[model samples]
Target: MQSVGKPTGSLDPKRHLWVLGLLAPASALLPSQLVTHTGLAFFWWIGPIIVLIVIPTLDRLIGDDGTNPRDEDYERLSNDRYYRWCTYLFLPIQLIGLIIASAMWAGDDLSLADKFGLAATLGFVSGIGINAAHELGHRVEHLERWLAKVALAQSGYGHFFVEHNRGHHVRVATPEDPASARLGESLWEFLPRSVIGGFRSAVALERERLGRLGKRWFDPRNHILQAWAMTLALFATLTLLFGPQVLPWLLLQAVIGAALLETVNYVEHYGLLRERRANGLYRRCSARDSWNSDRLVTNVFLFHLQRHSDHHANPGRRYQTLRSSAQAPQLPAGYATMIVLAAIPPLWRSVMDKRVLAHYEGDITKANVLPRKRRRLLAVRRAVA
Candidate 1:
């Protein structure tokens, strides 16, 4: 395999920009350094600031990037070790940030507001770390799969490794999938369902799989157990090193981080559903079922996770090789903007409900919808018709 990462006739112009992804984990350290020198408390919240404000603005100014490699270029791009290092480097830097944050949280001379800001910073990093984990988790390599769980440890969402690849991918875009958002479902309403539902689904899936492998539910071979064990070990070590005072900040950051990931989930497949077959099985997922964005800045920051339509269509494809499909539904803005919108239910419905309805040609029945709101929505449509 000759180097496809760089060649005179290389296809990917943004290959060097992939390094921008390090900004996410590096955020925890950068803000801390800035605050240390400048004494500006606002810098403590840099991670969220980068996400909520910076990325969205950049998406507007920089605009979309629909570039995709040729089909013939897929294998070389996918196996490029350079791309693998980008994700592999994330885990260690992420852990280093958490350790530094823990030390600061335990004894730093920061005010309460500043401490919370630091926690939010760490939370955003941990949350984004899950996206990195997601890309790795889809790979067939044993090391990448294990690295996915390690990346998830800071957020206490190690079960995501078990649930997302095994559970969410299979059931996505269905009423039965907890991760898929329904029409008229608020983000607040979807949060607990996705969280608890994902956990329960992972447990059940692991139990069933272990039964076949002649292993107990508690067996270390269970991926969920293994992932959670890493989280437990991480937490215990942090507590011992930094003292119990760091625990609350750790927990706060984990919650914030998990929420960040879930907000992405809420935005990704909101009101999108797969059609069922005559045999009662759902149709295989296509790009049509997931919302997509091609904002160059966000795509680079997120490791092309925003090119989600192609991701579901090719789960094992590296982010470098994931293509944007014309068949997929498009989001009005990058996920950074959408995640903020998802938090405000009324505003969210105003922007997204019509889009959902249009996707199914105004047929509410075709959309995955909230059962309680179904009748009212249908009635409104009929009266307007």
Candidate 2:
């Protein structure tokens, strides 16, 4: 009922019920994967149907709810055990769902369509799985940090823990950040750069940390390598239990999940650049540096990740406490819908390029536009002049 982008003053702490959508993927997938074994053709399509179709449609119909938790409620809401338990419980559910999904993939009863839908479903769930990791990974508690690595291991993106924390966050919104999408770079171009560059950045960060401690790059203290070891163990165990065919499905789903992560990276800071100081260091990050979305559905499902600007500014802020700012650039749609739109390069540019241009009030040079599009953009400016 609230208008998209309009503030819905002070939210009730009880509204944490929105996170119930986090359970939807498991409910959709576990049953579908199991029921398909009974030769029910319709169940195979359920996961993709609910995630791709149902959620996105509802996101549109529901629009945004720009409600910030009242300051007095911040401590109570942030420290809520129920919120933490919701995320804590996701770890086991994610592990179990993966096992069931893998077994289903390895079974011969599933048709190609069934397997395809399952893989898409796994990818969809795994993307949210990484989001769960992202939330826990930021915490200072030992259990939460380890849980983050465990979640990342599910999608074979364990290195994300190191790169995102030590590397990407340190260099976000600058040319130095591979995870930050440059203006005019399509999602296809951004994906390889983010994925490969992000991995390399993680390795370098870990290698540096080890060097400071006079240890080898592959030292046991290296958290990045530790995460990868967990991934290898997960794959090996799954293979031994479910046969070699399950390995490909796991890998495919991992790629899909990783791509989904990079897609978020692409959209979050697209075309936003920090000011380079005379000393050559970029200005400090603020709410203005990242794109913000307040759509309630995806925000709840992803744990308020849509309020990215506040998260970037205060990395340790619990998801329940992240607030939206009117000054931060707003996305045209929630992440799920925007991610699908980002897949089509021309349509993405047509819709988003003008937004980037508008954000800077047509100061094209202020954006991180790629070299290939620079000449054309300049020509367009000249023609318009």
Candidate 3:
């Protein structure tokens, strides 16, 4: 299948910046209402519907075809200036939203819908938005890296900063990587695997980083210890201000966000695998390695996250510049819809298994091609069942 081209219409960074900034205010809206009067349950749904569905639809309508591509001379702009501003501006938006939500919880009368809405906003901002920022932060610039950490801090997932860039990306699609979903693995199966695996990988990475600096796991300089300290501090602060009730809600939001991320993971590499070489190393990830989505609506809301093929091919490319590749596997729908489908395990397996088989068949037709590693994973899983 031919991959879709980059957006071809007017492309304005200002528009995206504005939309991202608006997230804080949008999230703050229902919470602000909840603090004063606890009965506006209906308004909670409004924020998510508008954010996850309505706004994305509108973005598609407007279209961000790269009509006004960044000038070649744009590289001369100080990377530090851009990174600091993005971090300083966007990071506070999430923090402000979180504060408002926590305050609302402290108030007496909160409708169930209001609580749900708060959770939804947190999930989007922290999970999807922050995660995207983390990916962007890893660009080859000092400023972007700082902004990425700020984004991660907002989500309470700061370990991702170290683990993703230094750990997950390096080990992706391998059994050792928590972020990678195995072929034929159900969404239900992928969750605990990702969560537990991710945590373990983070610890392992911290140890390695520390070992290089002549420190041990318990050393004060240990990043893993530092991450735990930060997490504990956050919990203590929330417990003191908002009471224990806030903890469950916070975890709920995080779970929702993490699950959304994993669902995307499942779709992106389902039943796809690299070939093992004579030296027992998997082939390097290429454009054809990942599933790509180019649907206009999803791409905009996700900050072009669906351009997975390009991302794997060129990890340092900016979201604005990532292109689709014909060699990559294509998703049937946007990430949001696919996420929903993935929740239904039977339906997800049925739909995706056919796609996997087809891709494998195509590979088999090529001369001198070897069986993909994903095929072995799937076969092993089936045998175990």
Candidate 4:
């Protein structure tokens, strides 16, 4: 057994195998049934209980085998083909869950709380699970990319395909990036900014991308426009077929999913900054640039999204094979706990600001100044008050 924050070079094979054993079946079954079986309050309780008790305990109890990072097995598993297959498996499973959820919502037998719970569950799974698909979607394969878009569409966030790859990636962890939460910004504050800001940026980026190819902003070939249209069409179809009631439920699900996605963005780089050179260019991103989480449970459920530092460094890496980096910023807790903590702005700042300080202890040049900027901004607002 090892401590939660203990440093180990490679993943714990026992923990990894346990995750593979538990998660693959749970992922397949949970989202589909949680919503569909409205009579079962037990299902909802079961998941949170497992997450809180079983996963965390396993994380602590499992010991790591010291495998060298340079091992051929690690190298082979980390390659593109593994990730591509993972992407293929992800899409159909998600679509089936969404369809089952929608069917449950269409039925009149379900209670209000059941409906709300279903929407919430759908939002979590769609936002987190499907967002993983979007990450894989931007890679150099056509099938994987298409599957990613389909997963995004199920969540009604298909524009992420356009925005995240072409827009957000290029501007990540910068002031210009909406998805990048600024220092001292609460999760509540970051939500509107990320959603509205990401949407606007995606449109702007689409126009720019199209212009380069001598296409108009509203051109049918523009993916941003196409995605937006598809999203609206899906909403319209849901509203028409299932009646207007389903529209609110769908929107609620979308909002929940979007909030979860933004909260993730908030945690990943929070206050991290890249230095601008005298020539007014920021330093290029490296493996050390983003926060990484290697907790076995979270990694399997989120498709190794916690290996964010690697993803940022090598944006094309598939989720299955993303590796934990020695130099990356690490999270104290899993994404679920982190999301809850981020809701309280001052607490999040108090905790994460210390992390920023620790990560930059020796080097002032590497300090993320966004927290300072936020402090100054807050002081000015208080003075006006």
The segments of candidate 1 whose C-alpha lies over 4 angstroms from its true place after superposition are 1-9
Question: Runs in model 2 with CA error above 4 Å?
Answer: 1-14, 24-28, 31-42
> For this target, which candidate reaches the highest TM-score against the unseen true structure?
1
What is the overall TM-score of model 2 with all chains considered together? 0.93
- Candidates' TM-scores? 0.96, 0.93, 0.79, 0.82
Candidate 3: 10-residue stretch with minimal lDDT: 362-371
lDDT of 4 at 319: 59
Question: Considering lDDT, where higher is better, how would the candidates rank from best to worst?
Answer: 1, 2, 4, 3
Q: Give the distance in Å from residue 130's predicted Cα in candidate 2 to where it truly belongs.
A: 0.7
Residue 220, candidate 4: C-alpha displacement in angstroms: 2.8
Tens-digit per-residue lDDT, 1-385, candidate 3: 4345744444444344424544533465555565448654555555456555765565456443333234552343323244335435655666677666777666666677678877777766666645555565567766666566555554566677677777767766566566766555778878887777777778888888888999877998765455456656765687788888787777776666666666677677665666668998877877766777776666655656778887877787666556777677777666666776788889987776666656666442221112354566545546755
- Clashing residue pairs found in predicted model 2: none
| Candidate 2 or 1, higher lDDT | 1
**Overall local distance difference test of candidate 2:** 0.82
- lDDT string, candidate 4, 117-227, tens digits: 667766766666556556666678676666666666656777788888888778777777788776667788778888899888777788888999999887888775565
Instruction: State the lDDT of candidate 1 residue by residue for 166-218, as single tens digits.
Output: 89999999988999999999999999999999999999999999999998997
